[model samples]
Target: MEAALTGSLLSLSNNLDTQAKAAQKDSQALRNISYGILASDKPSDFRESLDNVKSGLEYTTQYNQQFIDTLKEIEKNENVDLSKEIDKVKAANNRINESLRLVNQLSNALKNGSSGTAEATKLLDQLSKLDSSLSSFRDYVKKDLNSSLVSISQRIMDELNKGQTALSNVQSKLNTIDQVINSGQAILKNGKTRIDRLQTVLPSIEQQYISAVKNAQANFPKVKSDVAKAANFVRNDLPQLEQRLTNATASVNKNLPTLLNGYDQAVGLLNKNQPQAKKALSDLADFAQNKLPDVEKDLKKANKIFKKLDKDDAVDKLIDTLKNDLKKQAGIIANPINKKTVDVFPVKDYGSGMTPFYTALSVWVGALLMVSLLTVDNKHKSLESVLTTRQVFLGKAGFFIMLGMLQALIVSVGDLLILKAGVESPVLFVLITIFCSIIFNSIVYTCVSLLGNPGKAIAIVLLVLQIAGGGGTFPIQTTPQFFQNISPYLPFTYAIDSLRETVGGIVPEILITKLIILTLFGIGFFVVGLILKPVTDPLMKRVSEKVDQSNVTE
Candidate 1:
C-alpha cells in the first residue's frame, strides 16, 4: 500500500509537470494566432473607413434633399426625383457599418486567445458573408448611385442657372461618395480573403491545442484510480495489517507454556523407554557375539563424550557468550535504519513562510479596494464631447492604478520594515509586489471600467479562488483537484511563488518565468481595457440605468 501510494503520487506529479510544458507550447500557438489576427488592424482602421463613408453618405443625402427642394421651386410643370437612389446609398452605408461591427466582434474574440477558437471561427464565417454583401453594396453605390447623382448634376448645370450651386454641390458630393465606396471596396476585398482563410487557420490552431492537452497525460489516467485505492488502504485497511502483527506476538506468548510442556513429556517418555532399549540390545548381543563387541565399543565412546562434557564447562560458557551478544544488539534486530533531513533553503519560521501569501493578499486587496471606491469611468460630463471612451477609461484608470500601487508599496514595504519577515532579496520582493499591484489594478479596474458593477464581482471571485489555490500557505497539489487545476491560472499563484523565492532564495529561471507570466496577464488585461471600453459603452449605460433605478446602489 505504501509503495502503491508513493508511486501514484509520483505519477500525478510527473504528469502535471508534463501537462504544464504542453500547455506552455499551446500558449505559444495561441499567442502567434492572436498577434496575426490583431495585427491586421481590421477593426480600428476599418472603423475609420466606415466613419468616413458614413459621414460622406449623410452629407450626400442632405445636399440631394436641398437639390430636390430647389427643383420643386422652379419646375412646376415637371417632377424630378432621386430619393430612391439616395435611400439605396444610405442603406448601403448602414450595411457597411454592420460589417464594421462584425469585424469588431472578431477582433474582440481574438483577444480571448486560444480559449475562444469557436467564437472567433463563428464570427469569421459571419464576416465572410457580410464582406461579400458589402462588395455588392459598394458596386451598387459606385455604378448606380454615382451615375444618378451625376445625371442630376449635369441637368442642373445645363438647364437651370439658378440651380448651378446645387449642381456643384451634387458633383462634389458624388466625387466624395465614389471615393468612400472605393475605400469600402478595398476593405471588403481584404476582409473577405482573410475571413475565408481564418476558417482553415482555426482548425490547425485547435488541433495543436488538443494535441498539447492529450500528449502530456501519459500516466495520469492510469494512476489516478490507484491513488484512491492506496489512500483507502492506508485509511481503512492499514489497521488490519497492524492487528496481524499484534496477533502474531500474542499467539507466540499464548502457546509458549503448552509447547514447553510437550517438550517435557517427550523427554520423560524417552527416559522411561531407555532401560527397555538397553535390555533389548543385551538380548540382541546374546544372539550375536559381534553385536556384543559393537555395544562394548559404543559404551566406551559414550564414556569419552561424558568425560569431554566435564572438561571446564566449555559448552555452557559458549552459550553464555551468544546470549551476551544478543543483549548488546537486540535494538538493531528489531529496527535497523537511520534517516537524516536537510532543508537547503530553510525558512526562519512559519510566519516567515506565510509572508509571501499575506503580501500577495495585501496587494490584491489594495487593488480591489481602489476599484470599488473610485469609479473607473471619469463620468466627465464636460469632457464628454472632448474625449473618447477609451481616453476616459485610461485617464481614470491611471488614478486608480496609482492608488493601488501605493497600496502595494505600503504593504510590501511594511512586511519587510515592520513585520521583519525573512527575505533574501528585498528589492526584488518590493518590485514584484508593485508589479502584482499594477496587474491586479489593471484587471480589477478594467473589469469595473468595462462591466461596471459586474467587473468588481469578477475581481472578488478571483480573490476568493486565488486565496484557496494560490499555493501560499499549503502546497497546491495537496489541495482538492479543482483548486489544483485552477492553481496555475490564479493571478496570485506566480506572485506568491516569486515572493517565496525572494523570501528563501531566488532561482533566476523561476523568477524570470513568473515575471513573464505575470506581466503577460497584466498587459493582456490592460490592452483589453483600452480596446473594449468603446465596445462596452452601451452595456455600461444600460447597467448604469438599472443601478440608478435601484436607489440602493451608490
Candidate 2:
C-alpha cells in the first residue's frame, strides 16, 4: 500500500511538470502574439492583431484553468495546504480577465478613431497592478511550487511587463495623433473663413480693375496723339520757323540801309532836276515818306512775332488752339499761319534749300556703306610683314577714299540727270561732293580701324549727332545748345556750306576756305587712324576670342 501511494504521488508530480512545460510554451507563444499586435502600424493590422490577441488570451485562459484543475486534484489526494495557492491562482485569473476587458475597450476606442486617454490610463493602472500581482505570484511559486512551475510564472510576469510597455507606447502615439488632428481642424476653419471673405469682395475688386483698364484705354490714344504732335512741332516745325525768321531778319538788316541810300539819291536827283518833273518828284517824295515808314513798322511787327513764337507759353497756347482746330477739321486741314508772305526772287524755280543737306547725307551714307562692307586688312598677310598697322590703315583708307569719290560722282551726276538740280557751278558741285565724301570716308574708316566693332558703333553715334547738329536742314542755332556748340566741329557743317555755295553761286574765297577746312578734317582722321590702330587691334583680337569661346560653350 505504501509503494502504490508513492507511485501515485510521483505520477502526479510528473504530470504537473509536463503541464508546466506546456503552459510555458503557450505563454511564450502568447507573448510573441502580443508583441506582434503592439508592433502593428496600420488600421487593418491593428484589427487583425486584436483578433489574434483575443485568440491568444483564450488559449492562455484554458492553460490557466487546466493548471488549476491539476492543482485541485493534488489538493484532494495529497491533503496538502493548497487553499492559499488556489486563491492566488483565482486572483491571477481575475487580473488577466480585467486586463482582457481593458484591452477590448482600448481596441474599440482605436477602431472609432478616439485617443482613449481615460481608458488607456485605466488600462495602464490595471496592467501595473497585474504586473505587481504576477511578480508576487512568481515569488510565491518559487517558494511553494516546484522549479518548473516557478520558471513558468516568471516568464508570464516578464510577458505581462512587455505588454504593459507596448500599451504605454501605443497610448503616447495616439495622443500625438489626436493633437495633430485638432491643429489641422483649426487650420482648415481659418482657411475657410479667409476664402469666404475673399469671395465676398472679389466682384468689387474685379470691377474696379476693369474700370481702371477702361479709363486707360479710352484716354491713352488721345494723350499719345497729343504727345506726338508736340514732338513733331518741337523737332521739325519750330526749328524750321526759327531758321526762317533768322534768315529773314538777316536779309532785312543787310538790305534796308542800301534801299534807304538809293531812295535818298533818287530824291536828290529829282530835287536837282525839278521844274520839268514837279509832279513826279512830288509823287516820289510822298512815296518815300509813306511807304518807307510803313515798311519799317511792318519789320518791327515781324520781329515781335518771331520773338513771341520762341516763348514757351506762346508755343503752348498755339499748340492747344491748333489741336482744337485739328479736332474740328478732323485732321484734314493744314496748320494755320498767322501771316502770309510773297517771294520776290530774281530767278523763277530756284532749287530747294534742302538740296545741299540731301547731297551731304547721300555722301555720308555712301561712306557708311564702304566701312561696313569692306574689311580693313588683308587676312592672308601676317602683321609682322612689310605692311605696318599704319600702312594697313592708309591702304584701306585709300581704297574707301576712291570708292567714296566714285559714289559722290555717281550721286552728284545722278541729281543733275534725274532731278535737274539747279546748280550754279556744276564743276564746283562735283569737286565739293568729292571732298565731302573723302572727309566722311576718312572719319568712318579711322573710327573702325582704331576701335574695331566698338569703333563702328562710335561712327554710328557720330552720324546721329551730325544729323542733329550739322545745321543741314535747320539752322544750328535753333537746335539744343549742345548741338549748336558741337556744330562747328561736325564735318557735315563744312560739307553742306561748301555744297550750298556751289549750288547757289560760289564765291571763290569762301569756297576755298571751306575746302581747306574739309581737307583738315580728312587729315585729322587719317592721323588718328595711323596713330591709334596698333594699340587697339590686339586688344580687340583678345576680346573676339573670348566672345567666340563663350558662344561655343553656350
Best by TM-score: 1
Name the top lDDT candidate. 2
The digit string of per-residue lDDT tens for model 1 on 1-554 reads: 22332333233324323332332333233334434444564423333333343343344334434433333432321235755654554454444345445435545554444334454445445445544554564556456644554554444333333343333443454444435444768757655654443243223333433444354355345445544655666678668878998999999999999999999999999999999999998888786876767878899999888789769786687567667888645765666576688988888888889998998898888887777776676666898899888878878878887888788889888998999888888998898888888888888888888887888899999999999999987998899999999988877998888888888998899988997998888899989888888999878898799889999776
The lDDT for every candidate, in the order shown, is 0.66, 0.69
Each model's TM-score?
A: 0.42, 0.37
| Residue lDDT tens for model 2, 1-554 | 22333343344445444433444443444344444444545433454555565665556556667667656654543245566667777776677677778778867877787654555567666666766666666555545554434443344234334544434443454445434444767757655654443344223234433444454554456556655665666688767888999999999999999999999999999888886588788889998998989999999999999887887588777677777786745443554434566543222244545778889999888887777788876575556587877777778888999999999999899877788887777888887888888889999888877776787888888889989998987888899999999988888888898888877776789878888988899899888778878888788779868878888632
lDDT of candidate 1 vs native?
0.66
